[model samples]
Target: MSFTIAIIGRPNVGKSTLFNRLVGQKLALVDDMPGVTRDRREGEAKLHDLSFTIIDTAGLDEGPKGSLTARMQEQTETAIALADALFFVIDARIGLTPADRAFADFARRADKPVLLLANKSEGKHGELGAMESYALGLGDPIQISAEHGEGMGELYDAVSKLVPPTEDEDEEHEETDEERAARPIRVAIVGRPNAGKSTLINHLLGEERLLTSPEAGTTRDSIAVEIEYKGRGFRIFDTAGLRRRSRIEEKLEKLSVADALRAVRFAEVVVLMMDAQNRFEEQDLRIADLIEREGRALVIAVNKWDLMEAQPGQIAGLRRDADHWLPQVAGAPIVAVSGLMGEGIDRLMQAIVQSYAVWNRRVPTAALNRWFEGAIANNPPPAVSGRRLKLNYITQTKARPPSFVLFCSRADAIPQSYLRYLVNSMRETFELPGTPVRITLREKANPFAHKRKRPN
Candidate 1:
């Protein structure tokens, strides 16, 4: 296992900014607002020749037990326990405060090697603040600017002293393209409140890692956990249940919803959980529509199957209803699952794998154009304002929810119904089901207009 480092600090201390710099990507959500990150996020980070895993944690703050902030602090403590080393960051511009001192004591109790980071250390005031941090008695503070990429060499030197690279790793090369491609697939579990989203995640992990209850909104922040299923790695993000916009009056709930939306945008596949008893409710349909609009691979998991009284055609009926209401994602895979009892999980996993494959599928251009020719011949594009529409060719522009562009004459003349027809035909013909398909029409210029026909 790689040496693990946890970056913990009070809110808005540039901890996330430093994490982004180390990982070389903006994987975490960064905002001017404090506590933007409510859950612990892990990433592989490299500094100079040193490679290790780094964890970005929620800002440490004291809160009443059972409150949302309290739960966020629990997440931070969990990261501290898991880390071999800790990066204690403070806002140099603002200088140290009671909270910084309080968290410093907290880190001191952890007994792990801790590195004091005086972030935003780019000015004279910052230097003065770094000098003040020495009074905390942690160690000499490393002055570094996370945003401007200054003082990284000192940061690297400090981290290296704590966790040195192994000799075996020194002889080994960097991760090849194929190894990188095999990284875990990101999946987000999302749905309405009390829809068994967290329960389902617990079942997959085979542990009560996520807090669950019968209450309507047990989950708040989007918590991501890594898992391995059938020799495949997946980083599953369990998101807070979404509710009607008008009903969300609490500021905290709104932030949680925003975080959940971010998880959906970042995920490769999303499992929309639904209560078996109250399946296909208005909120459920709305969430499904949002997922489709985001162009994500989707799997419908009707949870709590054990509670449902057995009916002869219950599964078939559920499938029919899903298809009828959610026509945008027509033919999406629906699996009946009991999160508490762990029934039908294998099939749900299979459906997710299949959906992900379809979302990433690419078709050959020649095959696509051939299918287009046949479909157009059977049901041609309608004439618009006395001019016949001509579709010259169709080609897939990209995949990961299969987008295509059709070069034709008078692109704006093509009706939405025609585009729908093409999308549906393409879906069926290309074996792509339960995935969003985008088709764009482009008008081809008429080159022959400059050479007028000679008067005969």
Candidate 2:
């Protein structure tokens, strides 16, 4: 394993800013609000020639036992334990507060190599704050502005002394044809609280990689794990159960929900798991709608199927309910699976793969326009303000959910119902089901209409 560094500080310090700078991406959500980060987010960081794994941790603070703050502190502690070194950041503008001193003692007691960073040290106040850090007895403070990308050379020098050099492999990232073609499929399992999302992932993994309990909201972070199912590589993200907005009072639970939403946004295929006994609830529909709106490939997994007694017409009823409730994903594949009994897992995986394939499907422009002409001929666009709306042509702009742009004379005049009709028609004609299809209307600019007529 490579050397790992953990960034720890009191609330509102520039830890996240430095983490984002090192990683060269805004992976962690940065906000002026204190305690924005509550979990340990890891990313590969490079400073000039040095490369190591950097962990962005939640602000260190004391809270009541079993509370959300306590859990966040536990996550930070975990990151501290995992790291070979630590970047203890302090807001230079504020100098040092009692909380900063307290956390400084805590970091020193951890017995890891600590790098003192006086962040936001761009002005006179910042310089004074950096000078005050010397009293903490960690080491000489590295005055730097994480936001402005200053003092990186000094920061690099400090890190270089602590961590050993690694052989450069910039070119090794080029993948072979076989390796490139066999990339892991990213799937996120999401559902309401106590819906057995963790149980389902544990069953698929054939081991307890996640902490599962009868208690609701056991998971508070979106955890990703890799597994191979039937020779196919899969990276599945098991997310925290989403409760109603009114029910979520704690700030930490809100962050957890946000993290789960990010996982959904990052995923290619989303498995919307639901308890078979209490299927198609209000929250379930909301989540399904969210998936559709995000334009992600979706698979509905009715979990805990083994618990429910087999009924003659139960399957048909479930199918009808899916179609009735979620018309947006009209033909989305639904599979019945028992995460505990390990039944119907193969079918669920197959459905996920199929949904992903559908999401990535593309239709030829010629065939698309041909179907468009036929669809318009069969049911012409409705007249707007006593003038018939003229649809010039249709062409797919992009794939991954198959977005199309329709050129028309009066684009704004076409009603939403008409667009819905065209989308449904395109879905049916192109054999596209379940995947979200986006249709954009564009008015062909009439150059001659603007020019004044020369004759009479």
Candidate 3:
């Protein structure tokens, strides 16, 4: 990114709506309610020819010290400190409130180039409010309706002036497979309410980069941050806690759950956080099942391990329980961690990297067929309805969850239990532990069946 810009404003001023439009994606959750966004979320913004990093911050509001609102304000302040420019957004339809006046001074105190944006500026009401904003001393307000994108041209002109010009660069190079492989591994930390997901990410980042609290579902957005462990780089996401479906009541929480699920789908590896006191609970199993169903690599992190007694064989017990609870992701690595104290952080990271590698693992065709034969020999696909099942062979179709296609005489006749056996066997043979292995049954194409017979 050439320059960083932060969008700061009072609640329900359409800051997030503007952020989604600038980023060309609905990356930020937008709602009519105030303070839908808490943590500062960043995205690459492109306006015509200009490209830069844009941050969406929480609503600027005053609250008691150490409260969630206060922490959110702290997040906004941090974004301001890191930005080269500020977009002071105000509701044009509603006109300036005390918050707009207060935060206008806050933005001015930052001493950066400020662009006063009168959001919701789409009509005569907007024009009146934009005219009212001139008293804030933040210069002429740019009237732009974030929802309808009415004055994007004006927004572009103002933003372009603040960004410094750079010499035309060389042509961009195409990314190679090796370079892609070496890029940061995307990992999402997900789990039930207050399972230390944010705490673990904060420890890895070695800073208070993400908001953490005893309050369940404190994180409303899927916040991603980059970190380097040892020599490898990773993009880790701190997501909102997921509760049982019956328990979700609020509309905002539902949106938060959807955002977290989106993060999981985008990630290469997902770490399922579990409270040590309540490990392998029904909800934890459900989450693990969801991760497996999504076909992402799984790593179980038993959090708050420091509070547990140092009993011998406790690690083995956890392993046994994990396999028993989540057989779909059997052999997945389980690490006991204390995110608050940073214990087992290194091991957790190692497990993540290892699981990612396994998820993308592929076996050569020769080796794969050999394993298929041996697996069939050990426990053949059982007969269904007294008809013998002819298993021809199997080939790996893809990786990144390691999918396969098995050619057989009767595709439908092959029971799911048999496929499960084959998957487990392949995992054991190829050392593909933990990652979800998919085997799709297909009937071998009969060449003559496609063509017309002689005269029959």
Per-prediction TM-score: 0.78, 0.72, 0.96
lDDT of 3 by residue, 1-456 (tens): 469999999989999999999999888888888989999999989888788899999999999999999999999999999999999999999998987999999999999999999999888998999999999999999999888988999989998898754555689889999898889999999999999999888888888888889988889899989888898999999999999999999898999999999999999999999999998989998999899999999999999999998999999999899888888888999999999999999899999989988999989999998888888888988988999999998888999989999899989888888888888888888888899999888899887787876886
Cα lDDT of model 1 overall? 0.89
| Residue lDDT tens for model 2, 1-456 | 789999999989988899889999766666777877765778889998889999888899999987767877887888899899999999999999999999999999999899999999998999999999899999899999999999999999999998777778667587886884499989999999888988888788776556566878877668777789998889999888987899998776887799899999999999999999999999999999999999998899999899998879887888899989998888888899989888999999998888887888889978987899999999999998899999999888887888989999978889999998998888788878888999998999898888988997
Output the TM-score of candidate 2. Answer: 0.72
Show the lowest summed lDDT stretch of 10 residues, model 3. Answer: 160-169
Q: Report RMSD (Å) for each prediction in the order shown.
A: 4.6, 5.6, 1.9
Question: What are the lDDT figures for the candidates, one per model?
Answer: 0.89, 0.88, 0.91
Candidate 1 local Cα displacement, residue 450, angstroms: 1.6
**How high a TM-score does candidate 1 get?**
0.78
lDDT of 3: 0.91
lDDT of 2 at 369: 76
Output candidate 2 Cα RMSD. 5.6
